[model samples]
Target: MTATTAAPAWRPAAPVPCAAPLPAVDRLRVAPRADGWTVTARVAVDPRDPNLAGHFPGQPIYPGVFVVETLCQAMAQAVPGTPRLRAVTSIRFLAALLGGDEMELTLDVDPAAPAAGAASPTEPGWTVRGTGRRHDGTVTAQLRAVFDAGAGA
Candidate 1:
């Protein structure tokens, strides 16, 4: 006879204090699709954003980390329940996301995947893909992220 073991359940870690709140997305909009959901948001980099301070003295450009953060935030909002980011499969920065550049972010979340709060080790979670583009249709960035249900009381 062969023995089998079930995968261990996943749980959220202890909460850690944060120094400050993460940046916000403006003019955010979420719409449901037949296969998934789409989120559209306007991101206008703030000149006062501390991240831009040392990015470059003379020619400061928007940091790629912030751009990815924006996409993660948008996905969390579009999807139901509290979703914790697990991994970023891929991300690409095509052009500089400069300050004051009102870029439009569009994210697509697969509806066929398990819901955030209902995900399990066997079921895994959901996948989200998106792109940030300027008004002129210039692609600023592209990314794919995986999320799982968050632990909550």
Candidate 2:
């Protein structure tokens, strides 16, 4: 008996619409301090963002990864010269960031010991740590990352 290998009823599905890319940050403010630098950034969570679409589907919440990216981007803008991320040493999500929530990230950038073998005479490393708080002052997330002071002259 010969077996026929025929494809069964394959129909192309309709194209799904895509959400527009959200900006890295809505507002950014940086200030210098004796200990380090303080960076404050605002982000408006849009329910229509792709990251929220399937994050909880019926109940959308801002993804934690986006929070980290937000902080990293803020650090890049707040620091002198370019900063290259070496590692995310720690991250914690304390509360849920819901759609329509306006979150304020307050990050502190301070000097840190460079990775053991990664340090050089001319370059230094920095640690960025901060918390994301809702407009009402509810802490939602915290993160810490190490970065190399990039491309020193």
Candidate 3:
């Protein structure tokens, strides 16, 4: 599909329907919403997970960056169109998420409103957020993001 022109505000990419179904390899469960996407996932720190080494030596906590990426994937699955993370404005690692923690990523896209710089309801621009809630019911981290422009951006 052709990419749409980006507006002054963050316009979400054209919404891509999530009818294709989730991939079996994905341990993440995606719940889509008009506002933003939510994801529940687990990390084993296996070699399969990207950038496992960057986490730490011996003690492997899931990388906070990965948490945001996972949330991005979840939001993409949920959001209609080509909503992509333009940038992570702010990310805070409030807690260390262990490999065993079942992470809950709740992204609040439209809620931030003016600050989020999201597009109008009628606009193609979409907002994205990242929240990491561990299986232990503790918050691991939170991410706020904005996206616009580019072919695969």
lDDT of 1 by residue, 4-93 (tens): 533223222212222213454665666665566666767677766776767766556778887776766665555666566777778999
lDDT of 3 by residue, 1-153 (tens): 112533222222223334421221145444444554344443333433434455565566666667665655555654455466656777899887665555656565553455434543333454555666766768878777765421343
Alpha-carbon deviation at 149 in model 1, angstroms: 2.8
For each candidate, what is the lDDT? 0.65, 0.71, 0.53
Q: Give lDDT tens digits, candidate 2, residues 87-120.
A: 8888999988888999888888887754433335
**Which prediction has more favorable lDDT, 1 or 3?**
1
lDDT of 3: 0.53
lDDT of 3 at 67: 67
Q: Residue 50's C-alpha lDDT in candidate 2?
A: 79
Stretches off by above 4 angstroms in model 2 are 1-21, 114-123
Worst 10 residues of 1 by lDDT: 11-20
Which is the better candidate, 2 or 3, if ranked by lDDT?
A: 2
By the TM-score metric, which is better: model 1 or model 2? 2
